[model samples]
Target: MTAIYRSAAGAAAVRDRYDTLLDRWPVPSGRRTVRTRLGATFAVVSGPVDAPPVVALQGSGGTAAHWLPDIATLAGRLRVYAVDAPGEPGRTAEARPPLTSPAYAEWLDDVLDALELPRAAFLGTSLGGWWALDHALRRPARVTALALVNPAGIGRRRIAPLLKFAGYRLFGAWGRRRSLAMVAKGSPADPGRRAVGEFTFATFEHFKPRLEAIPVVPVERLRTLAMPTQAHFGAHDVLLDQRDAAAKLREAVPHADVRLAEDAGHFLPGWAGSVVTFLEGERS
Candidate 1:
C-alpha cells in the first residue's frame, strides 16, 4: 500500500526527531507494538507493572513524546501507556478510518486486549479525548474512569479564522509557529516541547491530516455513561467555546465533574496531577 506521509524522507526525519525525544523522557519506558486488523499500533509503556493502568491518547498531529510532562507524575503511582494514535502524524500505520463510526471503539478495545488489560482509566486531550468518549459510549465496560482534557466534540467546535490556517499553509514554519502559539499554553522554552512542535509543523507542511467534525453525543447518551467521568477545559481556548462546553456538560451530565482552568488555552494547563486525583479517588 502507498504511504500516507507526503514523502518517505519527511517520515524519516520526523522519526529521527522522535528518537531524540525518547532519550529525554522523564521516566524509563519500553516501546511495544500491538498489531490490529486495521493496523499495527505503537505504544510507549512506563511505570510499575502491578499499578493500575492508565491509557493516554494524544491530540491531533501529536506523538507519544508530547506526554513527557505528564508521564513523570502519572507514572509514579500508575502505569502509563501512551499510544501513537494511528492515522495521525506518528509511527502508527497511516490508515485513516472514518471518525463517525465504531472503528475507534473497536481499535481501542483491540489495544486493551493486546495489553491483556480488561479495564483501565483513560486520559485524552483534544482529538484523543473524542476517541476516549467514543469508545466509552460504545463499550462502557472497558473504561474504568475517564478524563477529557480540552476535548473536542463535547460542544460545537469553533472554527479558527480561515486566514490563520491559510497563512500557515502559505508561509511555512513561521506562519505555522504563529498559529500554534495562539492556542498553545506555554512558550516552547523546553527543548522537548520545542522538538514536538517542530514535528507538528512539519506534519502540516507535508501530510494532509484527516479533518472530521466530531458530532456531539446526545444528552441522553451522555447521561448513560455511568463510569466516573471528568472534563477539563481551557478558559480561553480559541479552538472551541469552552464556556459553552462547561455549561452543556453540567446540564446534560449532572453527575460529571467539570472544571475550567483560568487563563488556560487549548494546549491545556499542567493538570496531570488533577487527573491522577480524579482517577485514584472516588467520585463524590
Candidate 2:
C-alpha cells in the first residue's frame, strides 16, 4: 500500500475511506480478492450471476468504489467486476507494473483466470482504457468487446493545458480545485457530481498518483482490434488531444464508435448510460 500511498498511515486512511464506500454500493455486491502474480487483486462483483460478464477498470487515482456512480446501471444488465487496479488507491497490491511492459496484460490475464472467466467484455476509463486496449491488442481472443472512455494511448497529450494545470497547483487548495474543474465536467451544484468530486478530492489527499508516462498505442496495432469497440473523448480535455484521439481511432478501427463531447473534460461523470447501451448492443 505504501507503494501507492505516501505513508503507512495514509494507506490505512484511504482503505478505511474506501471500505466505507463499499457499504453504500448502489447494488448488491460481494468483494473478491483474487490472488494474482502482481498481488491480491481486489474487485467488487455485482449484478446477476448468470449475466454476461464485464471487467471494469478505473483510472489512475480511482478505486473500485469510484464505480459508485455507474455500477447500478451497468450491473443491471451485465455482471460487473469493478477492479481496484494494482498501484491505485484501492485494496489492491501496490506493485505498479511498468506501463510499457507486458506485465499489465499478464496481470489482467491472471485476474480473469482467477475469476474463472474464459472471456469477458471490458469497460475501461482513462488509464484503465489503456489497459483494456493493450490487452485486447495482445490477447484479442480473451476480450469479447471494448468500451473506452477518454482512453489514453490513442492520442497525444496536449502540453499547454497540462502546463497551465501545473501552474495552478502552486495556489494550494483553491488551485487544486481549479485544476479539478479543468479535468472533470460537472456543475458544482449537482449533488451526484459534487459527491464524486468530494470523494476524489479526499482520496488524493492521501494517495500518490503515478508519474510514469502512458504509452501510446501504435496505429498498426490498433488496426488489429477485431472486437466490438467504442471510445469517448471530451473536446475540452486538458490532458490528451481528444480530436486527435477520435480521428485516429476512426482511421485505425473503421467500425469503432468514437464520440467527442463538447462540454466534457477528461473526467466524464455521466457517461454510464451510453457505455451500457454500447455494451448491451454487442450482446444483441
Candidate 3:
C-alpha cells in the first residue's frame, strides 16, 4: 500500500519531533503494538491494571500523546489506551481506511481483539469522536460507553477560512501555524501551550492527512448507539456550530448528554474528568 505521507523525509522529520515530545511524557506508560488488516496499530497505555479500559482517539494531525492531559487525569481511575490513529502522524500505519465504509470500525475491532478487550469505554476528540461513534454504530456490543470532544461527523463539516490546502502544501510551517492559530486557543498561561503549537504545526507541515471529506452519518445510523453517550463541543468552535451539533445529536440519540464549553474552541479545554465521570456511571 502507498504511504500517505507527502514525502518520506517529511514523515521522518515529523516523527522525530513526535518522539521528542513523547519522551517528555510526564506519566508512567506502556506501549502496545497490535496488527490489524488496516496495518500495525500502536496504543499508549497508562493508569492502573485493575481499572476498566478506556480507549481514546485524537483528532486530525493528532497523536495519542495529544491526549496527555486526559491520560494524566484518568491515570488511577481508568486504564487509558490512546491509540495512535493509522494514517495520521503517529506510530501507526500510514494506510488510511476509506471513511465511507465500516473499515474504521473493523480496524478498531481488530485492535480490541488483539488487546483481548471485549467491551471497553471510548473517548474521542474531533475525528476520533467520529470514529468512536462509527464503532458504536457498527459494533455496539464492543463499546461500553461513548464520549466526544468537539467531534466531527455529526453535522456538515464547516469550511475553514484562510486555511487552504495549497497554502499548507506550498508555504508549509507558516500556513500550518495560520491554521493552528484558529484552534490552539488555550489560556495564555498554559505552560504546555507552546509545545502544543509546535507539535500541531509540525504535524501539519509533515503528515499528509486523507483529503477525503468526512461525510455526515445518517441520523438513523446515529440513533443506534444504545450505550450511555456524551458529546462535548466548544461554543466558539470555528469549524462547526456547537449548538447545531448538540441539537442534531439530541434529536438522533434522545438519551445522549450534550454540552457546549463556553471557553472552548476546536482544540477544547481539557475535560477528562467530566468524560471519566460519565463513563463511570455506565460501569457503576
Candidate lDDT (C-alpha), each: 0.80, 0.84, 0.80
Question: Which residue pairs of candidate 3 clash?
Answer: none
Q: Candidate 2 at 97: error in angstroms?
A: 1.8
| Candidate 1 lDDT trough over 10 residues, lowest sum | 185-194
Q: Tens digits of per-residue lDDT for model 3 on 1-284?
A: 76767788988888888888777767899888999988899998888887878889988888887875456777757888889888888899887868988889999999899988989988998889889988988888889999998888886576764256446647767766666676655424365656765686667665666678877878888888889999888877777676778888899899998887777777787677888778767772
* CA error at residue 61 for candidate 1, angstroms: 0.7
lDDT of 1 by residue, 1-284 (tens): 54667887877777777777777888888999998767999999998987778899988878888888668888887788999998886778877778987888888988999999989888898889889888888888888988999887787677764347766678776787777777675433466556666667666666656666677777787878888888999877877788888888888888889998877888775688888878877321
Alpha carbon deviation, residue 52, candidate 1 (Å): 1.3
Off by over 4 Å in 1: 1-3, 185-191, 282-284
The TM-scores of all predictions, comma-separated, are 0.93, 0.93, 0.93
State which candidate, 2 or 3, has the greater lDDT. Answer: 2
lDDT ranking, high to low: 2, 1, 3
- Please provide, for model 2 over 115-231, each residue's C-alpha lDDT reduced to its tens digit, 9 standing for 90 to 100: 999899999988899999999998899999999999988999777876775577567688778767777653233555556656666666667778788999889989999999989
What are the clashing pairs of model 2? none
lDDT of 2 at 22: 79
Error of 1 at 190 (Å): 4.6
